[model samples]
Target: MGSPVGLWVCLWHLSLLLLSWVGSAASGDCKGQRTVLRTFPGFVSDGPGNYSVNGNCEWLIEAPNSNYRVLLRFLFMDTECTYDYLFVYDGDSYSDRLLASLSGSSLPPTLEATSGKVPRTGHG
Candidate 1:
């Protein structure tokens, strides 16, 4: 039988390869040009009452100037209402950034959602 140390080394390498493949798949298709820069979420009061709920949020986009489109997905759900927000940032300077925001609402057990893309043109 092979040495225990040799088996462990082989397993470690295999695990690394699998992780790389999974990471690539999770980022979506963009000719290997997409990445999630940052993400933040918070809990808030469901409505006028004292009740509160949780939701999901994310921020992802293809690297700027990659000549590829950007897709942004966001979902928020709570007892009072559900909300979804999406935005795009494109400009020569930070001051010229663009923002597109969207939101949805519905009761519990019924999900309200929205999604779209921010197309990219060679000219910013």
Candidate 2:
């Protein structure tokens, strides 16, 4: 038996762990790759790992250098156009600015973003 404070602390720790698990399980960034904005040569996929699916993910990547702009090339993409779509935002967040909305089985053309250290988030 533990005191009320002790029980509350245990519950708090459990809740924290559950939150972490949900974040990983739902978004599939178990490796915490999304924890930091990408520099370059980033290979993004749905939750878990490559070919992983059934969930949503947000991939944030920034320019490789301060002087170079970001050119994103999608080598391959096969998704459900209506249900599963990849959205590119010019800025870090998705608000009043959308760079591109891609879906279906075709590869999209290369994309460029500002080089002012502005970040971009890809919601898939």
Candidate 3:
């Protein structure tokens, strides 16, 4: 086994390497906004072109009727791993049950809410 002092040094270097990969882009026009979706079929994003740094956006998707539950399908995603995240909640707020915390280049699987409400949030 590796010595305890060597293990700690390795871990410290790993943390610094991870932090260096974040914040390479400027904040730009990436502002925080909340969108409420009451329609059946819709789309949402940070707008045209590539998403900038320091973005915090939220979308509250609700089923059109009482008999249905909200479903989310990710068309595409490629955020910085560990630093940026896409958070999915089963209910209306952040205090609800967290369905997934997604990041990196891979596309996440489809998520269905337990109730009629779901919140999708993205932060960079």
Best by lDDT: 3
Total clashes in model 1, counting residue pairs 3 or more apart in sequence or in different chains: 0
Model 3 spans > 4 angstroms off: 1-30
lDDT of 3 by residue, 28-53 (tens): 24467676776545555555455667
Candidate 1 structure quality by residue, lDDT tens digits, 15-87: 1001123222222212312334321121111123222123222323223333322333323322222233322
Clashing pairs in 2: 28-47, 28-48
Backbone collisions counted per model: 0, 2, 0
**What TM-score does each of the candidates earn?**
0.25, 0.56, 0.70
Whole-model lDDT per candidate:
0.25, 0.45, 0.61
Candidate 1 lDDT score at position 84: 30
- State, as a TM-score between 0 and 1, how close model 1 is to the true structure: 0.25
Per TM-score, what order, best first? 3, 2, 1
Candidate 2 stretches with Cα past 4 Å from truth are 1-35, 47-54, 64-67, 115-124
Worst 10 residues of 2 by lDDT: 8-17
